[model samples]
Target: MAEIRLAIVGLGKIAHDQHLPAVAATPGISVAAVASRNATLDGVPCFLTIEALLASGVEVDAVALCTPPMGRHRLAAAALRAGKHVLLEKPPGASVAEIAPLEALARDRGLTLFATWHSRFAPAVEPARALLAEAEIRSVRVNWKEDVRHWHPGQEWIWQPGGLGVFDPGINALSIVTRILPRPLFVTEAVLEFPGNRATPIAASLRLGDAAGLEVAVEFDWRQTGPQSWDIHVDTADGALVLSGGGRHLSRDGAILHDAPEREYTEIYHRFVALIGAGASEVDLAPLVHVADAFMLGERRVVAEFHW
Candidate 1:
């Protein structure tokens, strides 16, 4: 098969750090151009907007969107309408209602639309999944706490109304949780703690359950001071299972079970190439759906201000 000429939209930190490098390293892929409002690539073609890029007649097979979740639907819709496959960054869209339209557009155009979740491609995650499949899960707990200033820095959009705030990282946990568990889960109750000055929450606690009465509680806080934790612990009939280091390591019975270097973006690129080659679309919004449900049904409380 011929190489897929790809263009990247929204050249932000994720594009520079993850997508760019991964595209460069992957086979059967070439980044022909980049679209960003405030940045430009040295050698590759750059455009200020997606419409401008399409209007310029830059022939490319696919476009990867790395924009914030707020206004991504229109860009994605346009890309699909223009007959270009789209690879959306995680949290696909701002709301649950937005995803169906994009999916419909992609189907109407017969183009591949991939909503990438790089975290699910983590090495240890599948291994952990295999171990947990047979065990009778008794309970599950997730502690995903980090210092937002250290992680997100001065990114102001994260606190905006549709930006997802702490869930910007929390969804990664949800993705893994949804994958590893044996059955589907739904949010029962949730509490969102928002900064007095922001529209998004700074912290969230959710209670999730399955039909079998399994209990899973998730806690996300963007105010942790030191030693950030991205840990998920599940207790089952076969001792206890621990997936730590953002699903890069696994431990059980106080012993390390599995560990490997992270190649999440590499795997994501491989999958993208394969999906494009086979004319397949991969867009799973269950994680984001749960987030939206939490937001709609959660009780909100005002908290202290957050300043970087």
Candidate 2:
């Protein structure tokens, strides 16, 4: 019941911008140490690797793995085996196969392993899910476009094999869609636009459907300029439901329903703490599974070169 002594594993942009601030604001939690090869947080012990952090005996109750998906599995397994709860960032692992063993390990050890989908904590997501629960669904359209240069900046690992390309942000949309809709959705057809110079796609268009013949069209692009957009439009027998601003704002029939401040990371920490207190783990792989299915079944097209 005392303050959870947490250590952050990656000191990247997301950790500095979101995780640090969220941890500071949340009660009953304190950042005890950090482990990153190239970055460090002020006033905390920094280690070059998770192995070093564990061997140093820093006495951390939990660790948040903010590293890229490529290295998440190993770091998380290490933390869990060391008798510490683990919090994984979005997409969890590079592939679906990498997550099962870690989940099993955590379950067997009686430790909490939280695969956090931060977007699910958005203000409008729950409301949208609640409303759609009673409405007869017709169709869904997701348009998630943004300029990657502005958002990613110098993040080169994004174009690598496990980087997830545009899906890095696109997965956020998928997470919300999977949560809000009443039925389970799976990819039927997909087209990926990969740059000649990169291993990942710059854009993707997917057609997803469930058993009830409900089809949803999704578009993800990293080439948008000027005005950025993250909107999901759902059409049902009742009317139109729009979730714009990345699930921060919701509207029905063009009338505002819910719009509030964003506190995704804060809520994520809260959930992590609760899970630790309850001695349980929350791991959802639907969004990541949809992504893996897309890769297995989707057709790939080579596009013009993309430069940072």
Candidate 3:
């Protein structure tokens, strides 16, 4: 197996908890360097900025970008222009428009540019998709709620314009929705609830539809106090299909169907390696495009001030 020399561009929580471990376990990937403003990995060469990393002659073959969506485009573009394969974390960029440019850059450079949707790689999602494909779907509902303070802590960036607030997790639900449904769905109505002191919404409610008259409703909240829920249920003619635990478990008719260890990031890394080897790009922006469309179309309601 050819080892792909990789650099991690963000040293944040997701990088620490998921990316690092997954990359360490992947067969054809190696972390050659990392770039961050104030974070570092043990024994890994660290640079203060991406430009510095590229200037250091690290001989990296690919770059994984886990930075906030706001500044991701420029970094990914630079990496592709430098003849390196690029892996972009979920919610690929701050705006859907930006991703197309990066896509073009990678195409022009003949490099791989993958928009990683780790949630779609959950073990049970494929089974759930199979189950749903056979059903006459009537309606769908998604409930993704968690405590913001517990998940994000003092991370103030999430509340900013491009931070995505509740939609950060909500898009994960959208990614699964797009993957499982037999048809494509588009947003019909949406309402975003923003804290008075914040630029992004703390919660959102969305109504989506497909050409086949399928209706789907989604609710995203970051204020759940206990027993956080990440569930998606589909009503069908045969039986009810449920994907719970953020796609980790699947159930139908109140019986467990599939359950397995979550190896989403690992699968993501493997896919990245395959894309690089094929000299192809896997760029799907439906999830992020819907997000930006929701933001553009949804009515905003200001609630109480949020502090963390």
* Winning candidate number (TM-score): 2
lDDT of 2 by residue, 4-53 (tens): 99999989999999999999989889999999999988898999999999
lDDT of 3 at 82: 82
Specify the poorest-scoring 10-residue window by lDDT in model 2: 289-298
**What TM-score, computed on C-alpha atoms, does each candidate reach?**
0.98, 0.99, 0.98
Best candidate per lDDT, number? 2
Displacement of residue 204 (Cα, Å) in model 1 is 0.8
Instruction: Show model 3 residue runs off by greater than 4 Å.
Output: none
- Per-residue C-alpha lDDT of model 3 across residues 1-308, encoded as one tens digit per residue: 47999999989999999999999999999999999997988777999898999999978999999999998889998888888999999989988888888888888888899998889999889998988887899899999999999989999999998999999989999999999998988998899999999999999999999999999999999999989999999989988889999999998888999999999999999899888888889988889878988988899999999988
Residue 68's lDDT within candidate 2 is 93
CA lDDT, every prediction? 0.92, 0.95, 0.92
Q: lDDT per residue, candidate 1, 125-182, as tens digits?
A: 9998899888889999999999999888899999998999999999999999999998
Quote the lDDT for 135 in model 2: 85
